[model samples]
Target: MYKATYFAAALSLALFQSPAVATADEITILAGDLPPMFNADGSGREAEIISTVMERCGHTVSFEIQPFTRHWKTYASGTGDAVATVPVGMPLGGHQSDVYIQYQNGVSFLTDAGNTYGDLAALAGHSVIAFMGASDILPGLKDAASSFKSYKEVADQIGQSRMIFGKRVDAVVGDGMIFAEYNRQLREQSGDLMFDPNQGVTFQAIFEPSSYGMNFRDAQLAEDFNRCFAEADAEGAIEAINSAWAERYRETLGTQYLGH
Candidate 1:
């Protein structure tokens, strides 16, 4: 009976020590319009991070980009599993769950020169250009949206560059990466126009330092995502992801703006 006991103990150990298998399913991620995070090219840094973690966790993930207001509405309606770039501890209108990603949202100014501004108060009385539905990114500037001397959304980057060249506004305030990337692409196709870092035009300000994470409709999904995210973070995957994008942005800017 010693041999029998030994076999039973081994079996028990196997069962107890084995890692738990995660459920395989497609998870829908809702996100607002943000470049280098969830862009049209599908090369967003956060998108890659989520994809890597979910794949390792035996799940498929997809994203649907919409306006910030609409994204919140859809998530709150309980129709999807999670929304990206959500502020932590955000009171859900109806949805539930606590898992989230960590990041910050801030304002970036693009001007004729590459000058940096420390805060919103610095732009007092200066005309600023921004998109109509970017309140989530620039909460303080929302009130001044109408008072601005100019405003326009060309639905793409080309028109934005044109507007900037035409002096529609003194500067543009929006996602730094988005504006930078778009201008980079524009300068590539046309050498005449370029972003000059030495022009003293670009400035970035952190309106509110907040954590961005995925909000889940169900607690189980949140738990799973959190587990996968933590595992990925421990494995250094998150750092790698950020590094890759940072390098790309630097390269892009170096080539387009710095004229390197």
Candidate 2:
């Protein structure tokens, strides 16, 4: 019966080594309405990457999208599992986690007509608009709130656009992608208005070149995700996702920033 006993031990070892046990854990990802990265529709490139990687590792995954600030608060409160698409160089606060993805260069500036802004210094005397909680990304501008006007809602983009057209604000300052997307939507609603990117007169990158990644509440899960993300990046899956969305954005919006 020695052979039978040996077979039983081998089977037990195999069961213990299987991935199923690890997958029994669930991972909830908290995200914001950051496009091309984390979309409210669950169709962002980062979401796809996370799904592919985590699924292969046998973990069930889900997402909750809130405002940028609220997403961080919820994750920080330890009410959920993790936060995804956090901008590079931003503090994680209580959520000490690993980086899972690195996005390419992104710019922030005003777009008027077909023109784009090339420098932020040009906006020194002018009023600039920004989101409520994005100060960390634009620390200099954030501290100079008195010099520039700020808004707390996403609809502020529309307000700023109108303000620019009406000469109420000197210029709008925010994520280039968000601004482009907002402008495109307005163009659809009102057929006669043209945004000359050429009208984008003043520009500046308050933040340095940065990337984004996922943050986890559990260190073990963060390790697992990092390993999976690296494997996917190596396999060209991440690149494929970015390329697919880039093409789609260009086809639909005629701009790359809108998709991101």
Candidate 3:
């Protein structure tokens, strides 16, 4: 009986201390469509940076789309391993990296008439539409835009471009790089598309840059990413990827926000 008992205890110990099975190595990322930053299709500047950084850290990363309103809910429910470009004032219950991306939110207009309104206060009497989450990420822009004759919120950046071109609204507010891309895509999509006659759009930077961070559920994984990011960042890999995009939108991004 003593020998049998000892053998059972030894077996249990062996099982407990045995090499753990290797599961699929992947980190699931969740985010909404916030163009030039986070895209549902996984091609934004931040998305590119995160994937490159995470992969360099020896892990495969995948992205899942959720609207801004529902992305956090899904992340909190333990659906995603990490969240990219987390907005301000959102709950930071888990580990998060340093500010990975700083968005210089700005106002964009299609026609010269739309440019007349220099500041947010001056936009009170105009019809305006802006990207969703602007209210949270850009409170001042949202508040000032609220006093407009009519204010609307949209999910996709393309919608903003459509509204501006159709004369549906006087101005649109969003990131400079995104607005430029939206216009280009619309123009490309408009070949034999519609009878829209509008041109010369630009985004005016009026608000302070808002910072967003990469939040992770696993503390160790977060730390790991942070370390890898530091090395990649030191080599200017992130900035190198963004410089061309930033340079492309220099005029619309304003003279103040391009120092990075």
TM-scores for all candidates: the values are 0.65, 0.64, 0.78
Candidates in order have lDDT scores of: 0.54, 0.54, 0.68
Question: Mind giving the per-residue lDDT tens digits that candidate 3 earns over 1-260?
Answer: 00122123332332222222223478888886655666668777778888888898898988887765456555555567787766543453467687667766667776466256557897888898877656655657646765899988777778778788778888887666777777777877735645373477766677667677776777777787889888998999988877766776665554534453
Worst 10 residues of 3 by lDDT: 1-10
User: After superposing candidate 1, which stretches have Cα over 4 Å from the reference?
Assistant: 1-24, 93-114, 133-161, 188-203, 251-260
**Better candidate by TM-score, 1 or 3:** 3
lDDT of 3 at 97: 82
Q: Between prediction 1 and prediction 2, which has the larger TM-score?
A: 1
Ranking, lDDT, top scorer first: 3, 1, 2
Model 2 TM-score?
Answer: 0.64
* Candidate 1: tens digits of C-alpha lDDT, residues 26-46: 877787766666786555876
Model 1 gets an lDDT of 0.54
Alpha carbon lDDT of residue 126, candidate 1?
A: 59
Candidate 2: regions farther than 4 A off:
1-26, 87-97, 101-116, 133-136, 142-155, 161-170, 188-206, 251-260
